[model samples]
Target: MAFKFFDKLSQDFAELLNDKKEYNVVIEVDKEENMKSFTTHSVVLRYRLPYFDKELENATTNENHIKTIIKPNISAQIFEIILKYIYGGIVNIEDTDTKTIYELMVNADELELKELSVKLENYLIQSKASWLKTHFSFVYHSIFDSDKFKDLKKFYNDIIVKYPNLIFESEDFTSLQETALISILERDDLNVEEIKIWDYVIKWGIAQNPTLPADSKEWTKGNFKALKITLQQCLPLIRYFHIPGEVIWKKMKPYKKIFEEQLWDDMTQYFISPNEPITSLILPARIISNPELPSRVNEPFSTIIKNEHVAELSSWIDRKSTTYSLSNIPYEFKLILRGSRDGFHPKTFWNMCNGHVGTIVVAKVAGNDEIVGGYNPLSWDNSTSTSTRMCAKDSFIFSLKNGNIKNSILSRVKENDNALRYFDSNEQNVYGPLFGNCEFMMRSNVSDFTQDKQCQCKYMESPIFQIFYNYEKPIRKTIELFSIVDYEVFKVI
Candidate 1:
């Protein structure tokens, strides 16, 4: 019986040996504090080897078959996190670990790994770290639309309140500055009026970090390209103050050509089209307020005083057309005016009144004016009750003459000897800090530029003035035919 039991026990022990197996898995790591190294295939393998293989480092005879490799450039923390990702494909969002994720995102950006960067950014946004908040703001601003970052508005508001000067304050923002500035402006609650002041601040910043001509080729080209993109982000807000990036950019001649080329591209498109005639020619207008309380002497002054001529014309155009279609006006026609910064608006007004010989009212009686079109400012007010009014009580009839025809245009541009050649005839308020360069002609050039002769010049490809002159012939003929019917009626006006 004892021999039979021994035989059964021996068979059971052999069965137990058959069920056990060994794993020879390889796991490479940066540090050995949390891992063990082993040898395999006559090569030194530094990894988290199995316990049986952990004793492989004890075999010095195997050193001859071993390779000693340097540790990876990764940090221990990163290595462990990477290992975690390798094992479970997941990472924690805690503050200590979140920084590692951010660095990963930054590395992803450097590597141009779009999916990785996006995923990391999403994780950082959820982490809610204050600095991460700023970073994610930049990432979201660049990658997505303004509304996508709306949830971060309170964060931006807090930053702005704490540092009101932060809008212009730039550090090494990498590739995201443009999107960040534009996104900030797009927030409806933010104050747009502060844009000019912020622009000046940003200008100062760029000037301080001025792109010098002697700079290395890469910086001059690449850095300046980035700077230009940032400035363009400020374009929409700058329009409100008529302060283009060019105003500050001209001083930095290192990137002058680049900036000019960009500004030309942006503004030129708006100017080239015939639809936005006034906007094309006229710079943005300023608003002036009467700070002093009205006294008995000055009580009639406007509460909000401004040059309303442009606004008046814009309103009229808005009213007359459901879709910018000026009645009887050619689709390709535009009315242009030439003026200076000091008195541009008023000068533009005067240009409307007496500057053009072919289009002004004086052409009917004296053959000395040019009439582009006439407007009753109030008739153009889009807010009018009827919405289609064509006349206003306080109205002015102004016109445009041929600018390409030199002699006729010269007559209307009266020069003043008192001021080294100034257009002293037109009386309108003006202010200056002239941004763009414009050429001026002495008064004698006005009539020459306004003549009705067919343009033989190759540059005047459109023949704009010829079109204007012919279009108004019916109106002029009506006046002339009316005078013959009743000669006494001509004296009324």
Candidate 2:
């Protein structure tokens, strides 16, 4: 067996990156205002990066025989990391922030550094998953623009498949790229109703052409043709044969001009006669999964609360004097966001529970059996720039009865105008669900609720704080802030 000195060789190559004496390539990166230039070796760049090889070929040399390449779109910080990886085969991202690392991965992919880009992509998915989910829209849209990150696409699509509403109901759903929408529609387990999917597709197509008439009945032939062309890529992906005949007649009949004459005829015939053969291709029905709930098999519905707690909470929601029975609870608590499963970051709460309405947020107090929570009948909005108070007469905060708690306390909103507080986009990183006058609020200065004792439940019984009592009573006996063991946000369906 032969011994190798690759370690020494790598170190030497890394040192060469700092030597400006013999470098023949001058690379300029970032925009004109903050532009930076780096010196590199042509031989190393040619072998390490395929993109650089072609770029170098077309580049003309100066009198000093140094080739210059400019990349204004790439930030100087990201290119510096890439340059180091190219020369030394080392990427020291230990101190780099997640956003910077993501930018590095994108730049590496653009530079055709497959190994570096793939490594960064996997690292982001495995280690920085919470951040990815927190910035879901940006990450999802950016990845679909290029086909290089297949793993990231799959990682996000897995989440989208289970919770189709995350993407389908988002504010930017209309702005979604055609390729991205097609990829989602092509999934066999999309977990949305066929008619709903049809509606969303039509909605997306209409959004693309704002000039189209608002009423489908008022559409001219040209308007229909314009819509048909806009949805050409997405139309075929829909499983026409699986949609109910009534739904098809109600929804699909309006857009009949979009479909090919033969395919539409075949669909009509297939609906009339189930056994009749048709020339058009028939896609299998999408596997509609169970309603949105915790997918963990053999796991309890919640770690903090149980069925009894759910019944009590249900009673509170319905304004009933007595708790409902376990078998006859009026609503189902569909798990939307769990701190343990999703993340403890305040931003994670805003990201996952943005548009959800009628949500129950329960948090397990650290080192105690006290389960403090609040019910918000209004939807959580993360799109606003300023903090907004939601008006709700039914919203309330409560302390559920558990091991040490002998009696449960429920406090309904005293001030309907200030029932709940929705933090602005900037403040979302520090604050989560806030109920009346900081009565029941989750806050984390370190961006994690579990790591800090900033979560507060102010005692409203004190005379000095009487004016700030937005709820009927304080959920906690003490006014001091505390940390939480875990938290969960469930949509009351």
TM-score of each: 0.27, 0.54
Per-residue lDDT for 78-103 in model 2, tens only?
88888888778788985687789998
For residue 49, model 2's alpha carbon misses the true position, in angstroms, by: 6.2
Q: RMSD to the native, candidate 2?
A: 13.2
Candidate 1, residue 50: CA error in Å? 24
lDDT of 1 at 311: 26
lDDT for every model?
0.32, 0.85
The RMSD of every model to the true structure, in order and in angstroms, is 32.9, 13.2
* Tens digit per residue, CA lDDT, model 1, 200-313: 535543653555344424464666665666566454444432434444444333444435464445454443552543432333433323233212113222121112322233
State residue 2's C-alpha deviation in candidate 2, in Å.
18
